[model samples]
Target: MTLEEQKEIQQLKQWLMQSQHQAVISGCNDILRRTREDMRVSQHILKEVLYLKAVAYRLLADVNSAIETLNELISYFPDYARAFQELGYCYLASDRKRAAHSFYQATRFNPALLTAWLQLEKMYKADNQSQALALCQQQIAFLTSLPRALLGATDLMHEGQLHKAEQVCRQFLASNEHHPEAMMLLAEIGIQLKVYSDAEFLLESCVTLYPDNDRAAAAYQNLLSKLGKFPDAVSVAKKRLQYAPESFTVKVGLAHALVGVGELEQAIDIYRELLSENEDRPAVWVALGHALKAKGDTREAVNAYERAIVFADDFGDAYWSLANTKTYRFSDELLAKMILLVDAEATKLDDEIHICFALGKGFEDSADPTRAFAYYERGNRRKKRTLQFDIAKTEKALQAQQQAFTKGCFNKTQGCQAADPIFIVGLPRAGSTLLEQILASHSQVDGTMELHDILGIASSLSHQATPYPLNVSALSNETLSKLGEQYLRQTRAYRQGAPFFIDKMPNNFIHIGLIKKILPNAKIIDARRNPMDCCFSGFKQLFGEGQEFSYSLNDIGRYYNAYEKLMDHWHSVLPGEILTVQHEEVLDDLEAQVKRILAFCGLTFEEACLAFHKTKRVIKTPSSEQVRQPIYKTGMGQWKPFESYLDELKDVLPARS
Candidate 1:
């Protein structure tokens, strides 16, 4: 009985053991299979979540998050140019154009990926010709000669060569008419040429396809405003302002419109408010300077422009404008204070140039040539490199222009007030503009601002537009005669009030020889200042529109040398046609000097000329404010403040010094 029971139990135990072993093997297999499935699901889930997260991040304005997600996705699938494009899209949306451009570079070609194409097109269209051209430059700069040619054309356009610019732009369009950028450029060319209707039409067409886009808006507004429908322009400006109120362009328009309708006082207030709200806005200050200068508050104008440069250190323009305003003749006391500032190391290049020039003029005004010369010499040498050349070039241009005028005027009909114009010639800071103001005060003489007519004739002689001809070595007698004719024809528009208009283009000294030949009836006044003070002032004061020569000292010196040679030439050839005014003599005795000037111009002396300081006139020169007030001795002997820094002018002064 015991053996049978034991055998049955053992059989049961064997059956249970076999079942347990099968169960363990089945469980292990199921676990391995399930683990593999779980991994596959996890990989898909992670990728999908990352993709959605990127999309969500972009929607939430988290550009960096979108970028990070795209970066992670690209790391897993490097062929995903879509991810690259998305990353670029995020960057573009963030207004990082340069970075977006780089990302766009990595995007693969896919015609169906219209977003990428549109983005690229927009980027290219949005940039300036020079800047946009830079993007394609590396790709095309070496590929074909056409790119270089295009670049040349672009530069010519920038320098105001409109016809040449149009020719180049047209040539570019001929080959690539549908190239959106080229189309946009053509539109710009139309805008520049004053074919505003054509430009407006083109821009409107562009907007129909790319509705509410920036480029179309810009084109429409720029063209509309330029046509002087300022109210419409302001309305357009407000539309743009609605979307981007902080845009310098839009704000400039608003400010300009306010200034345009004689709302200068309001414009000033707008600028002041803008500055208070955001002192970092440079354009606002620049606009303020213009308004204030127009209102005859030049000191505040200078200060506002100074603040503009502070906000935008690289803006050479603000420096130019500030110099122009502050550069007017300062009182001897003001000049002395400025000189002290320069000596104290608080003077910028602009400050030093202005003060030095003012000091020289002051000394001359005070009848002290020695001190005036010292200051002029210092001032000239302090100007920037570009400004020196400008001073010289502008003077030369004026001279050639003047001689051309004389020639042209003599040949004209007798009814045309064949009475020759008087030109007061000298370096800018040497009291030329000031002399013109004084001369202009006379009833018989009409002193106008710098004229382009003479330059036009000179340029005509040279076959160059705008700049006319020069007294350079390469002139023929026939060409010079034609230039003279051209000059006379151009200046006919300047006639007003008097038959004897004073063409007070001071730089006319260079071509006085030519002038003597053309207009035997003309009068020329050479307003001489101490060269040192003159040049120093030029170097310190930044001219607003042109005259890049005043930024450096070496250029100023070289310019002075050129002027001296030209003046010497004129004096030798023209004899008594030109009158010389030593700044010091005029300064020492303004009354006596004024009388002499009157006698020279063949005018009867008036009691009003004796009180020249009280004569109300539009003095557009730097010294307008000072000239409005009584002449003062505040500017004499100003060089003593910077006597320690006069190593640049130790003995380079004229022989008179």
Candidate 2:
């Protein structure tokens, strides 16, 4: 804790890092002897000392002493990935099987452990474990030849120290320019930071610099898919598959690309083929379930999820996949198992979060509101720890938008004449997907996934010092028009020659001014719901990605308030350009609402729109199953049962609209 002690510890750490075993041992022993005389040394520093001592012992070929030191350190810091990795090294030097298990734990805790992964690959190869061998090889291919310095970055990344990891990766890349591994690692960190443009650039560079590197190419293709550049992703995927004809990982990448391109059937077929070839792969089953669920085949999707559970019962994703259906009823046995697994000590954090959400859904359906709310709250709390949302920062950003996007902002630029896009924007779990389903049922509209083009554009503009809408206000009419054209070109992959297409990105509500400036003729539908219902619905639901605000009631309420204020601003400034549709109103009179929605989109009324439940199109949101059934008010007041526990939300949210 003292400056002198800290300096001494750093020196020892440097020596250990440089593999000076004798020096590390002597320095650590001197520190330990001094610490015994002075009780000022904290447990935190002591743990690090023990860890370094274990490393020194391992380097000195003292396996037993290394194991003893590691055991002592792990008793207090059981989740220490590096300690487990050291234990793995020591065990591998003594007992091969134990070493494999230790390495497995190392990778389980910190998936970015390239050394552990490579060691496991060798162990699995020796044991003739083909499936694990393939998985390990796939992981190795992700960063085939990691430079020594980048390993520290990867470790930091796996431990969720992304900013630190980014710093280290950038430092490495500064000297080792175009190093594919460092680029891929930094790109991954960029993805986690929501800096998609930078991530895309790095990935693109990685792929171009190493075209034969399957992993870098796959990472690039995956980034393209994440950005909703499915056509481009498909091109890249096809090229990668052409080179690695027998690689399952490449095939899976192609399946993801197909799904993104709205080729659900093709994606499903590919997933099925992959499963047939590797029947025990739980991930393949989950992927198949996703495609089936998106394609609106509820029964088959449930079957696929069940198969995933059967293959790997403790797999949390499979349970979450089933619960995400919103209509899947958990049998007593399954429910009990989920309850047990949710609290299991061995369950990984991500797995536990999924299991907790699934249990919440199960209890909700069983009419156990108290139990359901408890599980939901627990799951939300767990997820909130991972999010970096800041309410004050969000408020500041929202205020900047209001100040920048005055009525005059839109008057400066004449938007493109493309009336092809029908935009559904609102808060998540507020019926945007349902609106998309209704519109997609109409003959002229093509229902697309929550297209990322608009958001992507906003993110690119978000890099300015002023941030977001303030930065967007500087764009010229020509630039706006070009952006609009680029959006249409990017989204063309999801259109099937339909005159209009639906892009139901809920968060686009914040960018209404930018939307009008780029595509003034585009239809905008604001999906509004009751404040409590919308916020609580979002709180209970687990999104596959984004919506970080939904992980906590206070954050959700603050976001909803911001969203409401922005919607009011958009309506006042751009009247007749945005239509507001209340969820309850849709449920109250489905036919009338359908007519109104169709009329607003400048399309004729059709009876098919009234029967959107039977439209037979792909649905990907949490509301997928609910939207497949006839309109009902069952979801209307479900929030009341849990209202007593929602004071944090009530304190921030405006009254029901």
Candidate 3:
């Protein structure tokens, strides 16, 4: 409060941050001794010195030394709440969760110590439990007891009960304007809830108040990146890098921004550098793989993916990445290893979707569709979409796309290169894996498992500055043609020189428009299954990949609905461009349906398509294991298995559509 005291504080900060850390430590010790001898040493002064020591040790990564310092500080003054909080973190650094919790609770009685609860929240999150109410309650509850309503409301914002938190924030701000912390909290929460405009506003307001906080810089950068403002994200990352160049998280964010701006080489270089610095970090390796894959280095990308998993096991991401890279030797050995992993963990684990799905792909690649189908069914059962709705909509889309496609009244000529992959869309447990096997058996067709490649492109494009279909008028026909040409070029690597390549990505049903503009000649296949089964199947499966929407029942149902609506809209706009297939119909008359599909593709009906059951092709979808055997007459109209659990999804399903 006084000039002299402020001067002393400034001098202390400088002394603590001097060029020589040992010199700074010695200076701090001398100051403390002098202050104590003069009877001028305060509890605050002691705490500050201890805090500096703890921080220095932490920076050096001497966890034991940090713990000792923090422990000594707490023992010297057990009544100081911050001491307990810091000591708790030290305990946590040493993996003594219970001890850390004890100290955190001790600090709870002294509400000024925010780190106590914040660290507790981190501990909970690392263990993977949601704890908004428990950890975030500190600052909000503290502010609520104070005179500043704005600060109180702001505290609640980051605790994550968003709507209520915002109401508190607005109400507080209405009484007294320009409360910076409150505004920052509101902005931070807005970003979390995907309200970009509000977040930008609050973040801007916070910057005007506290311009030097690295945390604020990172937060703003993240918000900008998510909003598809890559340039802005890059700018902020540069500022943060200036402040903390060795910050790995910040480097990762910067790398992501570079990648977004199509600076593949630069991003790759940055990631490779970061990987070298943090050699064992899985994320750096993962990012390297992403960059390499985007740049079209499939083999190196696969190696990077494998290295990532090797460094960090239990990472389901590597499996998904490996499957997508398609660089490894697809052999029985890979499948057996995956199977062993799953089998070894079967008794200990309640779910095996990760292992089962990956192993199933191996079997499918081996042309053991029967075995592939079994694994797929196993994984799908874990997913819960059992054939009902998958079969129904699959049939409906099949008929609709087929009829429209047969009309063949296009205004333009058919000279453009189109993606003619057969897609099997529906809920996971739907008979898509079986359908893929049958279709892949055709001589002219190459059946790859459900590749989410097209969907990834569409999703990534949606995150672009000018999202397609959103600003359709902004795109000229030439641009559209260019986009299509680019799509063809990108997929050329996977062309396999086949007349048709099956793009069995189920989610492609959601992006039929992007598919149409790029590949006017591409065939869209919509696979449908029962709603109850679909949702149930989704709930049971553990994807650990891009199906972020599949983790919850409602999210999965809503996602399916969105996909269906989009498919229907695409069909209306581009009649005869898509082909829909029903799992049930295919099962009933495999030869007839296969013959009709072949005819549509301009190929004569091959008896091999009829004997698709006898064809041995790798069936890589979750249905891989199931399709290896003969077509089963069962699995159609089977809602009994999930009837009790289908209540939440009953209205979500299409009724007789």
| Model 3: per-residue Cα lDDT at residue 489 | 59
> What's model 3's overall lDDT?
0.59
For candidate 2, lDDT tens digit of each residue in 486-534?
A: 8898888788889999999998888888888888889999999998999
Model 3 RMSD vs true structure: 18.2
For model 2, the superposed segments whose C-alpha errors exceed 4 Å read: 1-106, 112-145, 654-657
Between candidates 1 and 2, the lDDT winner: 2
Cα RMSD, each candidate: 23.2, 6.0, 18.2
Residue 32 lDDT (model 3) = 65
Please identify model 3 stretches exceeding 4 Å from their true place.
1-415, 419-427, 456-466, 611-619, 654-657
Q: How would you encode candidate 3's per-residue C-alpha lDDT over 394-451 as one tens digit per residue? A: 3453344333332233323332455565556655666666666666777788775455
Q: Enumerate residue pairs that collide in model 2.
A: none
Stretches of candidate 1 exceeding 4 Å from the true structure: 1-285, 298-417, 464-496, 513-519, 650-657
lDDT score for residue 207 of model 2: 84
- TM-score per candidate: 0.51, 0.83, 0.44
